[model samples]
Target chain A: DQQVKQNSPSLSVQEGRISILNCDYTNSMFDYFLWYKKYPAEGPTFLISISSIKDKNEDGRFTVFLNKSAKHLSLHIVPSQPGDSAVYFCAGTNNNAGNMLTFGGGTRLMVKP
Target chain B: GAGVSQSPRYKVAKRGRDVALRCDSISGHVTLYWYRQTLGQGSEVLTYSQSDAQRDKSGRPSGRFSAERPERSVSTLKIQRTEQGDSAVYLCASSPPPDRELAYEQYFGPGTRLTVT
Candidate 1:
């Protein structure tokens, strides 16, 4: 069974608009959630992360909201730029599990200029 | 100043061949991890090593897969008798120990794409 899932295979947004990507996970033990962005032929880069203790975390134009009770999380990118186009992966892990992460299938985000 | 790196960015192998993929983690990082991403799938953890000792390997798909991190700086993922189903992009990541909160995030390599015929 997939512990983490990104139901949407892709998302598109016009530049300067808000882009929202959603993720759902079944593992209740997961306490740490993270987002990673990947460009073709490049490694994934850490984007942001949130601990279960908090409902939201933000970094500049990027914000991650977690609804632990719903086992759902969403990544919001405001004023999306063409440079933000990439594959976004949501990952989860139990802090006690020593950093081994379980990743979602990924959502391809395309920000049109 | 370098991030994790994997060698032979792309590899094509015939069936029954043995292949070894290498990863070089950033200096001083004490934890290394191996993961595989198949087409249309998420990256799955294959194994993890702390320092020079393997902490978990339960994710290795089968007996054909094995990994080693010697000297705590570099790691190798070896596949024996490769099969077509074994094709995937193998990714390596590393991070500092958990004691350093900000450094706990993993840095990934570009990944080695292995295609088995």
Candidate 2:
């Protein structure tokens, strides 16, 4: 069984618009979530992360919202830039297992200019 | 200043062949992890090491999969009697110890794509 899942296979957004990517996880033990962005021929880089203790966390144009009751989380990118085009993966982990992360299949995001 | 790195970025192995993939983690990082990414699947943790000790191997698919960290800086993932189903991208990541101030984040390598045929 997949502990984490990203329902959408792909998403497209116009530059300067808002892009939302959603993720759901079944593991209630997960207390922290992370998002990583990957470009072709490169490794996935850490984009943003949020602790389950907080409902939301933001960094510049990127914001992550978590709804524990719903077992859902969403990543919001405002004023999306063409450079933001890449595959986004969401991961969840329990505090006890800090080194092992459970990842979603990933969502491809394309920001058109 | 360097991040984690994996060697033999692409490897094509014939079925039944044995292969070894290497990873070089950043200097001073005490924790290292290996993960496998298969088509249409999320990345799965194969193993993790701390300093020079092998900490976990529960995620390994079978006896054919084995990993070793001879030292703190380098790790090797070895496959014996490879099968076509073994094809996947192997990724390595490293991070500081949990006691450190850094959050539970890991720095990943570009990964080695293994095609077993």
TM-score of each: 0.96, 0.96
Q: Which candidate should be chosen as best, given lDDT against the real structure?
A: 1
Q: After superposition, how far is residue A5 of candidate 2 from its true place, in Å?
A: 0.3
- Superposed Cα deviation of residue A112, candidate 1 (Å): 0.6
Instruction: Give the i-RMS of model 1 in Å.
Output: 1.1
The list of candidate 1 runs beyond 4 A from truth reads B54-56
Number of the top DockQ candidate = 1
Encode model 2's per-residue lDDT on B1-117: one tens digit a residue: 988999999999999999999999989888787889875588988877777786445455567777888877999988899999889999998887778766488889999999998
Q: How well is each residue in A17-101 modelled by candidate 1, as lDDT tens digits? A: 9999999999999988999999999989999999999999999999999999999999999989999999999999876776788
| Chain B alone vs. reference chain B, TM-score for every model | 0.91, 0.91
What ranges in model 2 sit over 4 Å off? Answer: B54-56
Candidate 1 clashing pairs?
none
lDDT of each: 0.90, 0.89
Error of 2 at B20 (Å): 0.7
Q: Which digits, one per residue and each the tens of the lDDT, describe model 1 over residues B10-96?
A: 999999999999999999898788889976689999877787785346465578778887667899888899999889999999988
